[model samples]
Target: MTHPELVIRKAVWKGEEVDLLVADGKILDVIPSSDTMYEGAEVVAAKGLLLMPSMTDVHTHLREPGFEYKEDIASGLKAAVHGGFSNIMCMANTDPVNDNAVVTDEMLRKAKAAYPEGGPRLFPIGALTKGLEGKELAPMHEMAEAGCAAFSNDGLPVKNSELFRRAMEYGSDTGKPIIDHCEDPYLAPAVGVNEGEVSSVLGLAGQPDVAEAAQVARDLLMAEYLDMHIHLAHISCRKSVDLIAWAKKRGVKVTAETCPHYLLLTEDALNGYSSDTKVNPPLRTADDVDALLAGIKDGTIDMFATDHAPHAAHEKEVEFMHAPCGISGLDSALSLTWSLVASGKITFDDFIRMWTTAPCETFDLPLNSFKKGDPADFFLFDPSEEWVLDATTMHSKGKNTPFRGQTLKGRVISHFLSGKKIV
Candidate 1:
């Protein structure tokens, strides 16, 4: 055989020491580093670095087509690469929104054209309703034809039960799942944080846990009746997880995700109404965080996503309720997650499975592994490294991160996409 174009020596492949060979955008083979040498290949040493499948975030908000002040396709893709993400599925919450085929196709073309440097593959989700109005369904078939991977109305939940059911039915034929931001607007109007002692102490409006569970219950029943797969985004409450787990036990085809902040932080972060700590489904108490971690370990919570929402400085620099409901997470998720895993709160393999394999399986993408002939997508991580996060040094356009100056573990030194390097 011809000499491989790239050779990564002394790396751990699925936890075993081996040399990985790549050519023409695919892994050609994995052999003992000391046993083989390609005379003409560009060899790189990977000793003591973890070689695992790259992350695939199923919930990301690029804020393109209008909100360039927050983020654009180019900047978002760059952040994805720096964060060690090889595949990203974006929500349909753009300016005009991704409700039509034209918007979907344009976003696809923009992402493909902007990232010649081998960033994460873009999988755009189309809107479920026109303008995400929660009244009329968009052209589901047409948008799917334009190559959307799924359908969603993130940043705004579909409040109309009848309209959502119709969208779910029409969306079933597209072979893609419908993702819902399950929150009942009526119950949580103008709410700034989780309805509890924290919101009461702060003298701010609160959103009850029932607000989220109500919508989750409605959506689950809808999915069961329609025989469709439904994905819940950024589930924070313990009740929501319990419901989903119970539903799964009864054999409902449903899956859910929680962001790193929700799994790590709690309402204590919002004690003084600092806008940075605020987020949708609002951070819960320490008990809630404990529940989320347990749910993750036990297979009730299927995956972990960044929910990497970004906003401009001015947008988030206002009073609590007037400020935006998200923070930039792409660059922080892995390191924070690794901290818990390293402390034996969760296994390292569990971390890999959630950030890599589970999301791909849920989205119907090919499962990522280190086997030969698979796409050469993986991250070279120094699991023991420690670093303090600095938002100004981040590659993401949005500088609104909550973990500023906090020490985190497990940094990605390099990322590979196909046969080329992205970081």
Candidate 2:
């Protein structure tokens, strides 16, 4: 059962009209549309569509090995493909946690079976601390040998600086980034919202900006001292952005990422106590949003990730304080990001670089490109398409999104992974 070669005709690629030829799971050629004539190849007329390298999300939670009611690898991969992402790095917060080689091996086996014919590739991040308890280090050497992309105690931050320094020292030898969820438990309340007008007016326990920026500052200093790479996850405060900029200026091996929700939504979204807006490192003031946008524009922020945490409907249907702190993002990340491009906050090329090239470079994943012999992992996108996001239509099992019912511009019309159309 041999598949025919795929030829995209008259597609707009890198601001020019070109024809793309994909065969044997690799891009064979990319030439001007007017110069090519493929009489027998499977032709796809992509006259007005845009062709760009597919996206890669470095932070996502596919609640498998325990929380399948929320999301599994199969359904999560579906959401990734639908969101125009060809690769995703999953967090190790599942039942039994991916702290050892056995769990990493099991996850890889499951992912391979899920995408047997070619879909989004899954990279598992091993736990930085055993059980994510943040007391002792996990078996990093064993997990790395079994295919873990990085080490993180995500969901919860490592509170002990000495323990984190030890982990960074160990990780420097492996050459993988030590990614941490930056938050000081002492500064953050048990049930926390952003410490500001929203929390004050609503009479809820507030998690101040220092809860995140303090940890970020410590991690950056430790990375500089230890001469190791540290990646910050889901930075949401102005102070955190400023700290990252200062660290980069001083030549520290530090990189940071932010989610789309932090850019598009604000504390205003919580006016009615919406549980969907109850993300960890809760949405901040308009000034913080402006700072994050500036960070993106000035290249202070290295990458953009979804932090695609999914939760069961029952888990998110409760009161804001009782509800789990996360929202399903794999289904809406790209669309929300396009809003930035549409508003001129970031250019189209910059969006592609942040979502695709930057993450791949930072995490040592395969660089997605249109070069000959590169895997045909890309998508045809429509920049002018308008559609309302209905959570019911989402491919993920979780319907916990703050963007439900919002009209968004731009969408992935078709996606190809390994030369096969998956959406």
Candidate 3:
């Protein structure tokens, strides 16, 4: 079937109105809107909408193969597109755990079936430890061959330093970075909140910043010794940022990412004992938030990831201490990040680079630019659109979000991937 030429008219590109012509699954041209003439093409009037390359998330949890109640490949991808993301890398923390080539192949097959004609491509991260048990190393070589984008033991950190080193060394050979969920279980066993005044007032067990910083410190040293690429996932504490900055100065092959919650919200969000605020590497103090912002400014933090963990509503409705540590983020990542941009904390270009360019560079994925011959992957965003985040309106099955009733500015109006409109 020959697809009609897709023409987006009057879209704002770099502060000027432009027309985008997409055909044959590529961007044919980008010309001044006034100079373009529409003929028999499919027209989309995008007046007053901002046009840019869609974003990518390097850390996400699309619970498939074991935990479909929370999220699946199809639902997760739908949520990603709704948030203006064109590519995502899912963590390997499923029921059986994605630890080998078999699981990796199965995920790729399912992803293809979910988006058959190339919509927001899904990349699976194979587990570094078998079953994420932190004992035996997973089949990295075979999984890599089967199309694993990276290796990570995300939900559970590998506590054994020797085992972790071996995994890092092996991962380096695959040319993919070893992403670690930096945490010391011994230091903060089953804790739900950050160790600080808020935790004390709320009477919840606190997971101190040291829990994450210590592990980050260890991983950085290991990366230095082995000279392998290490990417830290969802860093939340100030000390952790300090450690990563110190590592980069020493020329360690390390890159770190911070989630939107860590940058925008703090442990104070848990003031009312809201389980929705409970997240692994629990939210830290305002001081930590400030440090994280500084990290982004100084280039210590490489990218912004949603860490889009989703859980069932029933699971999060119970007592705060027993509730699972996560919140659905795919639907809110862009708006929340836009809040930062609007506040002048980061420039619009910085936000775009972090979400688009930085992630591609970190994962070695194909960079998307709305250039001629480039894949037609972009989104139309309305920065002034204001709306409340209602869980029922979301595409993801898991609606356990802390921002459920919050009003957010900016929203994705339309998205095209591979010259096809998926949202």
List the candidate numbers ranked by lDDT, top first: 3, 2, 1
Q: Please, what are the lDDT tens digits per residue for candidate 3 over residues 242-330?
A: 99999999999999999999988899999899999999889889999999999998989989999898999889989998899998999
Question: What lDDT does candidate 3 reach at residue 166?
Answer: 88
lDDT of model 3 at residue 254?
91
Better of 1 and 2 by lDDT: 2
lDDT value for model 1:
0.84
User: RMSD, each candidate, Å?
Assistant: 1.6, 2.1, 2.1
Clashes of each: 1, 0, 0
Worst 10 residues of 1 by lDDT: 364-373
Please give the RMSD of candidate 2 to the true structure. Answer: 2.1
- Which clashing pairs does model 1 show? 267-284
On a 0 to 1 TM-score scale, where does candidate 3 land against the true structure? Answer: 0.96
Please give, for residues 1-423, the per-residue lDDT of candidate 2 as tens digits. 233398988899878999888889888888888745555678899999999788999999999889999999999999999999998899999998999989899888888898887678999999999999999999898888889999999978888889989999888777788898888888864354788898899988889898899889999999889878999999898999999999999999888999998899888888889888889888999999999999998988888999888888889888888998888898888889988988898888779888998899899887667888888888999989988888666888888888988888889999988888889
- Top-scoring candidate (TM-score): 2
Residue 157 C-alpha lDDT in model 3: 90
